[model samples]
Target: MSEAATLTRTAQKTEHFDVLIVGAGIAGVGGAYHMAKERPGSSFVVLDVQETFGGTWATHKYPGIRSDSDLYTFGYSFKPWVGAPIATAEEILRYMGEVIDDNDLARHIRYKHKITKASWSSQDNLWTLEAVRTDTGEELRFTTNFLWMCQGYFRHSKGYTPEWPGMADFKGKIVHPQTWPQDLDYKGKKVVVIGSGATAATLVPNIADDCAHVTLLQRSPTYFIPGRNANELADTLRELKIDETWIHEIVRRKIVHDGAAFARRAQEEPEAVTAELLAGVRAFLGDDFDVEKHFTPRYRPWRQRIAFIPGGDLFMGIASGKASVVTDEIDRFTEKGIALKSGETLEADIIVTATGFDLAVLGDIDFSIDGKTLDFGKTVTYRGMMFTGVPNMVWVFGYFRASWTLRADMVAEFVLRLLKHMDEKHVKKVEVALREQDDNMPLLPWIDPENFNPGYLMRGMHLLPKSGDKPEWRHSQDYLAEKEAFPLIDLDDKAFVYK
Candidate 1:
């Protein structure tokens, strides 16, 4: 197909929804489950760009892809992962499929329905939407009263960026880790991965045995730390049978909240404790290697994403001569290989541009209210769940300090409470004021786009919280406080306008 032909064209309208949850990921499904449970009278539906549900799981099928965060805090509050603490990509996908099956959410979801735009009609308080089906190339349209977009940080499918000029000039076969084809064997191929985040770290060990040599290229360093959910915490919880969900949630909340506290403290004053931990990585790397330069980052420890150190697998890969790290800016690409700013060139049979994702804060949807564009840039996050001045919408973005599900779980609960309040009070719509009151408003650091080095739309930082701000502004990134703030019995207030 031609490149122009590959571009999505919007279709005409057909269906309607009381609530339309975009991107059928965990957040979208979780919100639907809550709505069904708390306010059964409310009509809802979810749509995914893919042919099936399980947004992240269904999309990213890379080799050795798994959660860097422990499974204890990653799974749902109502549903505890009964298998393992750390899970494989396939395992997580299976679990998500189970969530879809158990909740009977299949009928509510329309696969291959790629939503292109969501425009809110102020006069009617409804959003007219656009969609395209990949299989048929058919166009369609729909409408919804409210929208819950859980598209997460990445694009909806397997995307590798050839954004850098001269990418096509490279003589070597180029592959994006996100779009890793199962049939394209890397065995005995000299491969180079051009990225420095979690994906890069994880990809290193997975292809080591197959590749003749692999090089990880990075523009800047990320703070690296060891992580995993190796053991079976799930079996222990089941054996106890003490309200499995309750105990599971409690433990998840505890580990995430407390562990983040430790990480924060470790950052503010590494000498207080984790100095030895940093030293551990340095010692493992040895004196000849400049650990402080290649390993240590410029920002405070967790300011950016701390690379998940998988029990020294990456370091061991380097030490074993199977892999090497190259910190340099890419000047351009040549037919033979990639040339760096430092005038160094690396020859390779295959190249992997793990070069970050193209991020979409609100999933690239042109959202507008009453013909007035909902400039996401102009709004402050109200509790990180709802945006100020945006009406009848709830977005669930997780935490960098803790596991993604920790904040996601809280956001899900908060959405439920909001839905319940709407149901009880007979309120059809809810809107937040764009302006702030006094010094209470906070400009959080959670929305930093550079944290993950993902696609421009995939980075979920800068959307985070800051200290001393209201829970509306200050997302504590803590579990207990978030839980309390989320499940409020009476959410009606002057701040939250109801109609």
Candidate 2:
């Protein structure tokens, strides 16, 4: 057969759906549930690169892997989280399993199907997706009327690790938390973890007791909220025999209200918020410890995310003498360990780089529209979910300060509403475009570095889509403001182009 004949045969086997969702993580699973419940007649399928559900939970297997955000908000609003506010990865996966089972979403999900390319055809009013099954290496194709991108913002294949001099000369085994080896043993070994972020905080404590001695090396300090993981409102509600669903909703509201207030206070009175956060850490590490040097951050509270240390476990590990903290800049790696710029060399048998992750722009999938390669950086975001010139597609980029699921749930509702509106109008295509007023609006980077500049986001800001001055044109990342504004969004607004 000719090459064209083979291509024609493959195209003939392509499956089609009303909607196609990427990533089977929390956001993807929630998207599926909403489509099933609200748009029961619409045919949709979810594709994930991982072999199972729980995107991050399934990918990360490092020790002490758990949620930094409280589960009440991280979990789907439709489902009640019955466990502790901070849950282990295993527990989270189990909860996700229950959701899949309860909703009968298993049949709709295709695991190990990694989407490699997405092309939008204006003539056909459809999206053609090419995927490969990771397990069997089988090629697959699908077409859909709408595309729902739930793949997270970070690269899951590997974590980021900076190249240090003498790394090849060092005899010790170097590991990254994202790809933890299952058979590697750490018992009685001297371990050093690099980075001051949440990953380092979680790993040092969990491995302290087993290691001969563990040290946390950092270039700068970060803010943390050390507190008990228990939620008092949920406990009281349970004692009073309240329904689990009611408890979930009530506690979720309280937390959201408190979070909004906290965010406001952080902006209005940054000094006070910083002092209070430092005080929380001081209480955990005790007055004698060098909290100023080790715990005090240079930036204001909530500038970057303040990780919650459940039960103050990370601090407890430091206080117990099993672990120690070293705040210094690394000059380079030595034969034995890392050499600090201060002329001090710390020895370690094993080193773990908990630096961070690389941000993934639109699942790193090759995307093209109308035979032209789409440059996302050239488009302005529409409420951070949709892009200008992008039709019949929605991407779920969640909150940084609040639980990610909160925005996921909101976006699900918005997408459903848009779909229904399109049906009513008998339109086959819908896209966002700049209105006359937006022509002179100033375009800026996706996010302001001063507001929330994490390493991953800062490094990848150039690759992200731009934002406009108008509220409708920017992502905002403010859940409180979006909560009120999203519901009032007029589908027939001037910016919306329908055909």
Candidate 3:
């Protein structure tokens, strides 16, 4: 067939839905479940680029991969996490499968559908999406009145790795944790894991047992707090023969409240919290470990995410001589290992770059309104869910300081309430347009640069939408504050415009 003919046929093959979701991860799954429960009659479909249902859990298969936050808050509010507080990737993936099966959401998800662009039309009162099949390379199109971006804020293709000096000169194998090879073996080999974030923390202890030795090389230290792998409260309830439902509720509430209160304390009294956190580390690692030289970070606690070490496994590995931590700058790659600026050399058979992710908002999908391209940086966020001048669209960005699912649940509730209100008013379109008075409100980055310490977020802050000083414009990172704000949010606020 001719190119023009194929294009015409592809355009004719467009499908339509009442609502369209752009991912099948935790956010997408919960958003779909909530949407269906709120508006039973509405037709919707979730389009995912990956072959599986679990987004990150399915993709990241590195050793010792697990949840950074406790599953009580990380897991959906509607679902009960009866397992350990921190869970493995396999366990979490299984939980996701259970959620999909229990909710009957499998029928609504279209896998291998990579969305490329989404355009909104004011005259037609709908959104047109262009997608491609990964296996076949065939084009597909879809249309919907409401677009929900549940794809989390990172690129799925690859993790962010810096270009080191003379990387190709190294003789050893170099691998990124994001795309860990299934068949690659590291047993009896010396492995050097780069970066000091959660991935590095998890990788060192996990591979330490199998490998001859593992070295965690980092330029700086991250705040880490030793925590139990299992939730004692949940375990006690189970031992007492309490019903799972009641136990789930009690444990979830307790974790949520405690997490919120602790975060507040960290932000309000960082020094006290920092001292308290370091004291626990000292207790575990002991006086001879040189905690100040190796573990102390320049930033205050909770400014950057506090890495949670379940059972103090990382420190235990270091103390046992199976693993070690080196805090110094990497000068370059040598034939067998990495060379440090301090004139020290470390040998390794394998190198794992546990660097981080490349933040990609809205799945890097090109968005346009009324045939005009939209610049996200130029626009402002509406309550951190919707963006100004964007109509019938919601972006699922969670709290950085707390469990990601906490804010995701709130966004689901707020979207459903907004949809219901729009239905009652018989509104054709709902846009979050900044009023004249809103222009005077000082606009700030979605996340203040000085406040958070995640690498990807800090690098992509310029690409994110702006926020104002007011409640309607600010994105609340506090889970407890949002619990109150989202429940009593004013739907009739001047920030939203209906037609």
Q: Which stretches of candidate 3 lie over 4 Å from their true place?
A: 1-8
Deviation from native of the Cα of residue 310 in model 2, angstroms: 0.8
lDDT of 3 by residue, 1-499 (tens): 9999988887789899888988999899998898778888999999999998788998898988998988888898888888888899999989988988887888999999999999999999999999999999998899998998899988989999999997999998999999999887999999999998898999899999999999999898899989778888899999999988888889988988887788878889988998888887888789998888788888887888877899999999998999999999999999999999999998999999998999998889999999999898888998888998898999999888788888888899888888888899998799888888876889898977777768888899889999998877888777777788787877777778898
Cα lDDT computed for each candidate against the true fold: 0.71, 0.94, 0.89
**Residue pairs with backbone atoms closer than 3 Å in model 3 (clashes):** none
Q: What clash count goes with each model?
A: 30, 0, 0
What are the RMSD figures for all models against the true structure? 5.4, 1.0, 1.7
- Mark the 10 consecutive residues where model 3 has the least summed lDDT: 447-456
By summed lDDT, which 10 consecutive residues of candidate 1 come out lowest? 459-468
Ranking by lDDT: 2, 3, 1
TM-score, per-candidate, Cα-based: 0.85, 0.98, 0.97
Q: Which candidate is the best by TM-score?
A: 2
**Candidate 1 has what TM-score?**
0.85
Ranking by TM-score: 2, 3, 1
